[model samples]
Structure formats: structure tokens, C-alpha cells
Target: MLIDALQCGNFDREVFEELKAGGFTCVTPTLGFWEGTLESLDELGRWRDREREYPDLIKIVRKAEDIRAAEREGKVGVLLGYQNTNLLEDRIAYVELFADLGVRVLQLTYNNQNELGGSCYEEHDSGLARFGREVVREMNRTGIVIDCSHVGDKTTLDVIEYSQKPVAITHANADSLFPHKRNKTDPVLKALSQTGGVIGCAAYRNITPADACATVDAWCEMVARTVEIAGIDHVGLGTDYSHKTGPNHLDWMRKGRWTRGVQYGAGSAAVPGKVAKPDWLVNIGALNSVEGGLRRVGFDEGDIAKIMGGNWLRLYEDVFG
Candidate 1:
């Protein structure tokens, strides 16, 4: 079974049908990124309507059993998640409220610093703030999976040290391979694995070499090397697939009312705009190509299965049980 640990796709009935037909067992579709309480809750309601509209095609997953059941019934499970803590909005108690609302996965910060903690794009990482530590504790107690993908380096380390439950870098690549700000370093990767956390290697183009065009083989090689460093049990796919989007969406993702100017996320001044995606990894169905690429790269069936989705399943069981 294939599970996408993180996806920010422009979901619709057609997308849901495509995922079901493509044999995806589960996916954590990002519901909030820099969204406030009302906006976030509104998004959740929309997801609920979708489930009602296509009951046979998709269902909201609140537990590991839900994913297994979806797989058994040939339906796709949707795990609602947030890419930032904006919804929490300075209230630690809101953690329980969102957790009760089926928000199982959440990142502490996005690409810039917030009240909770520092971000990867910051000139200096202040590490976890006093409030950030409290947020981590609340998240652990509430069973919300912590994601440090776009968090600053020092903050990421602090979270790995603070959270009692294993956290996840759910949608980032290895810095050793790409050296991008969003990528985690070898030490951070090793430490995350040591804590029994999972790292979902992303297929976002900016996370690969700037000179090289994105390809299935390149993605597979990165995953293989990640397994070699972080172990087979700690690697999975989080593709970070953002399909059916355009420049306006990119502007919102990077600026998000935080700034009036364009931030050009994953883009540069030379080629500033929508970052190109690998054609083979554009959507959930592309997992077939990823599986093929892994097989061609010498991964045994068992290891391939783990990287494909087993590791994420185990993580869900442990964190969201």
C-alpha cells in the first residue's frame, strides 16, 4: 500500500477519484498553512463535505485503523494536517481543540518565524522559544505529530530533544543531497532516526541540484542514500506534491499576509516564479514510477515496501494510536 505523508494538492472530486484509482491507501492533505482559527476550521469543514460527497472514494482518517480499513475497501484515506501553527495562535489549549478536530499532523512553523519558534529562512535561528517548548509539550500530550520540515536548524534540533513522542520531518529532503535551507543536515537526520522518528523524502524540485532537472532516478538515489544514513525504518515518501496550482498560490504560500512583497519560495531572482516539478512525481499516481525507480536502484522488496509506506504506517500507529 502507498501512503503520501504530506501533500498540498488542489483536491477535488476528480482528484479523490484519481487517488482511489491510483491505489493510494492514505494521504495527509494539508488543510492549513498560515491560516487562522476560523479559516482552518472552515477548511476542515470543506474536507468533511468532500468525504460526504464521495463516501466510497475517500474518508477522513483519524486513526491507523482508518487507513487500514480504507486500504481493505479500496478507498483513499485523507489525514488532515497543517503546515504551520498559525491556527493555534498563542493558545496552547487550542492544541487539544484542533487535535479533537482531527488535526493529527502539524508543523511548528512555516518558512519564517512565528510566536512558537524560528524558521529555516531566518538569518538566525533563535532556537525554540519559551512558548515553543510549551507548544511541543501540549502537542505531545494531545497526540499531535510534530513536523519540523520548514523549521530552522536549531529549532529542529530543539524539537527533537523536547518532544517525548517521536516527531517527523514529514516533507523535506536531506541537506547532504541538496543543501537547501528546507533540507535537514546529516546530524539532524541521524538524530531524528536515533529518536525513532521518520523522514519523508520530498520530491520538490528546489530540493534537488539547481543545474539538474528533476527525475525519478535522482529521487530514488536520494532516498536510497537517506536510508543508508537514517536507516530503512526511518525513510518514507512525502513527495510534497503541490499539483493544480499556479503563481498566485505560490505568492500566498510564501507571503501569506506576512509580507506585501513576493517571497519567491523555492524560486530565485534568475528564475523566479512557480518552481518546476518532476513530471514523474506530479501526483499520487506517480508512486508507481517511484516504486519502479526504487526497484531499479537495487532496493529489496521489503525495503521498498517500508520506504513506500510501511514506515509511515508504523509511525502513525505509534504517534496517533
Candidate 2:
């Protein structure tokens, strides 16, 4: 039941081939982070064309049951999601509009702060604003899974406490294991787990850094530690496997019309480009390696099933109701 919570890579033939080969049930890819309404609509249109082109290989997941159904059909389920509410343009009604359009997941903020709330990169965590609270309610009402991957710590906590349904940190690691601004702190993990929310443990190079020295074993150990903090049922895969991203994708991701200047987020001026994925996660089949590593770290098949995708399905069933 392999389900990756997030993958912002280019959705090309090779990537979809890898997914089919890897036996992936579903993958939630970012449709928009900072794109405005029109651009977001274009993103959806591009995906619609791509899905039609590969009719046998890809199926857009409009519901949670569609994920399992895609696996049965031997196809990869595509869950359209966004990393920011900027496209909403302060319109509360747009939540239902996008949900009706089959956008199942919506992150509150991106790298920088906006109308919804603050981001992890912001110096001051203003917590959830009044509009942010309203947005949460609308998302809950419309059956969109609220994501807090790039959201500020304060805002995330506020959201977890305030939201009627569970909220997810779609793709990020635990700060206790690999302390980074992008990683979730112990408090955030506790809050998420207690509320039956899941944190998709990222296997991105910068966050996991599963290099020659660190190795896949170390990465799995990190996952084990995260499970200890976030609980086994509250952890899942969010590999952030960026395959075939263009040279300017990072520019648009970090600085999406909000700034004329360059914002080299997570990267420096010296290496202002997309960060490399861990060598072990080069393809979808590498998920087997992750399962093996987790076994070595003492996770049984049932618990691992929860981590891989079962818990996410449960959350979807609860929220996508």
C-alpha cells in the first residue's frame, strides 16, 4: 500500500514508470505553492492533460478510496495538492471551489508568511491569524487535508489545537533527529500525534542527508527515533523525491512573485539550486530498502504498514468524509 505523502518532482514518463515499477498506490504532488488562481488552474490543466496522455498509468485521486482502487488497477494515484493558500487570494469560498476541482490537500503557507499565517523561515511566528482560523474551518468543511510542512511552529500548533479534523505535516523530518528549521520540533510532533495526525518523514538529502557515511541504515534509525516521538501510527513516507526538476523551478518555489530578489531557501548563494535527493531514493523501488531498514530497526510489518500508508488512508477517511 505504498503511499508517498508528497513529491514535488516533475511528473514525466520516467517518473510515472518508476512509480508503476515501485508499486506505489498514491503520491500527493504539489500543484501550487505560490501560484495565483489562474496559474494554479493552469497547473491543474497541465496535470489533466498529462493524466489523459497516460491513461493506463495514472489516475487522479479525488477520494481516499480511489487510492486503493488505483493500486488494484495497477496505476499510480495522483493526489493534487498545494503548498500554500496564496492562490486562494483571501477568498474563503475558493477552498470549496478548489476542493470541488479535486484538490485534496492544501498547505497553509509556503516558505514565507502570507494571509493565512507565519512560516518556519519567518523570524517572528505570529501564530494563526484570524483569517487563518477561518481558512481552517473552510478547509475542514470542504474535506481538504490541511498541511503544515512549511508553516511556522506557532501557527502549526495553533492549527492542531483549533482544527476539528487532524492536520498533517506532509513532508518534513523531526528536529530531534536532524535538527533543522524545516524539521518539526518535539512539541509539534506530540501535538500532531495526539490529535491522530501524521508526519510524513522526509528522505530529502538536506534533511535526512543519507550520504555515503550516514547511509540508509542511519536514515531508518532516524525514522525509528521519529516514531518514538511521533508514535508509529503518526509517521509515514514523504520522500520529497525531486526527479527531473528544471533549473528555474527552485527560483519559482522560493520566490514566487512575492519578491524580485533571490530567496535561496535551504540553499546558499554558492549552491543556489535544487538539493540532491538521497542516492538510495533515486527511484520508487527504493521503498523496499526503506522497509528493510525499518525492519532492522525493530518495526514489525503491521506497524510499518501504518507508517507506509495505512495511517494516511485512515486520516483521509476521517477528514475526506
Candidate 3:
């Protein structure tokens, strides 16, 4: 499983041990989000210190090669990433600095408009701003993978066409399957695939629209449709699981303007309760984790390999090299 991060506050040695026991070879962890200049640097410093302290259980991985090496060495590769550009603020040079610190993936925005682009929750969806374009260009130039999962539709399409290298929708779903702002339409999937980019299907229940509750079967059906529309080569997996977080975390996620009222649809009053929810809804089922998800979906060995890590690995090599 490619996790988001292993910070001291969010996760600790116990969690890393559990991940190792669960057979997670690597994770693209978030390093910066909603942080200011000094705070961002401090976060980096904290991670650096943790890296030194937990050399045996975890290691910072900067390139695709490092992932393979970690798998072979029986250590979890911690690939750094950022979910928002807030940390970058107005300075573009910070892109290179974060890349040097092992941040390979960066989403252009979070939930609202920033210097880079408008977010999916933004009211007008004004698309990428002037600075947004520069941010994409700078990321490409610095060999960092650009992500557009939380970005607005227009902004996502614009970046896909504008980027010199293939960009990824690191965690999203097909809007046709589930019509949420966070989900992409069929056309977007086609366009992303055409650019050699990969779309990571998120395991969040709210992403699937069939019913209020989601199950593994529902998730597999969604994945099947996405593969049919985008092709198997452009598909990948991103669980987006915050497993250890408490109920307060869910409240926090929903309190945001963009995320307000956006339940995973399981048991949601919006949909009829009779329809079986997507397997991901309960958080304890076949789709609970990456390995179990593939098994339940009946994906062959080759397809499982690609979705689990190969597709992302290929993209990283192309952009981060």
C-alpha cells in the first residue's frame, strides 16, 4: 500500500510495523499541506530526523529505483509528496527545494483557490491561474510529478494539456460512475490516458454513486467501468486511507467548505438504503486495503502488479528521472 505519510503525530513506529506486517512496500506520504514557510521547513526537518531514527523500518525514496530497492530490502519506501501548494505560496523556487527533499508528487491546490489554481470545491471553477501555469512548468522542469485530484475540472484539463510531462490524478474516480466534484468524467479520463497519465481510483465510499453504502463489489464495478473508459494501462490504485484517525478526523474533513455534506454515500440519506453500498464504505471488508482489494476483484497477477504500484512506478520514472 502506498500510504500518504508516516509523521510522528499521524503515525509512529507501531503503525510502520503494522504496514510492514501488512506487506506494504512503499508509500507516497504527504510532507507539506496547509503549512507556512517556517512550518514547512520544520516539517521537513522532523521527517529528516525520523528518517535517521527509523532507518531499519523506513527509508526516504526519491526515485522509482528507490521503490524497487526498498521492496528487495524488505523496508517500506517513504516517497514524499504534497497535497496542496499552500506551502509553496508565491515562491516557485520552493518547488526545487521540496523535490530535493524527496517530494516527488504535488497537487496544484487543496480545497479552494490558491496562487496555483482553483480547487474542485471552488464556486466558479475559474481554472488555472497565471501562477498555476508557472507552477506546473516549474514542477515539470524540476522533475516532480504533478497531481490534479483536488483541482477543478477546467484547471485539471488545462494542466494536462499544458504540462510538458504526463501528470497524474493521483486519487479520484469516474464521475460517470459517481457524479461528485471529486470524480472525473469519462472525457477527462480519456484525455488523461491519451497523455500517458494515470488515474488512481480512490477507495473512498463517497466516490461511488450507485448507492449510499459501498461494498467491494461496487468498487470493482466502478474500477471495471473506469478501465473500460480509460484503458487498463492508465489505471492505478490510491486507497487514501487514514486508518488510524478518529471520528474527529471525519468531522474535520467534512467541515471544510469543499468537503461539507460530501459523505462517502454509505448509509447517506441521499441514496436509498436498500442498495448495497460500495465495499469501501464500512472500512472493514475486501476493499479495506490494497492487497485484499485486488483479491476480491479477481484481478490477475499482472493487472494487480500494475495497479498496486507498477503504473505509478512507470510514471515516476518518466517524470522524476
On TM-score, the candidate that comes out on top is: 1
Q: Kindly give the stretch of ten consecutive residues in candidate 3 with the minimal lDDT sum.
A: 1-10
For residues 290-313, write the lDDT of model 3, one tens digit per residue.
Answer: 455566767787876777677788
Q: CA lDDT of 3 in candidate 2?
A: 90
The lDDT per prediction is: 0.87, 0.86, 0.72
The candidates, ranked best first by lDDT, are 1, 2, 3
What C-alpha RMSD separates each model from the true structure? 1.4, 1.5, 4.5
> What's each prediction's TM-score?
0.96, 0.96, 0.84
How many residue-pair clashes does candidate 2 contain? 0
> For model 2, which pairs clash?
none
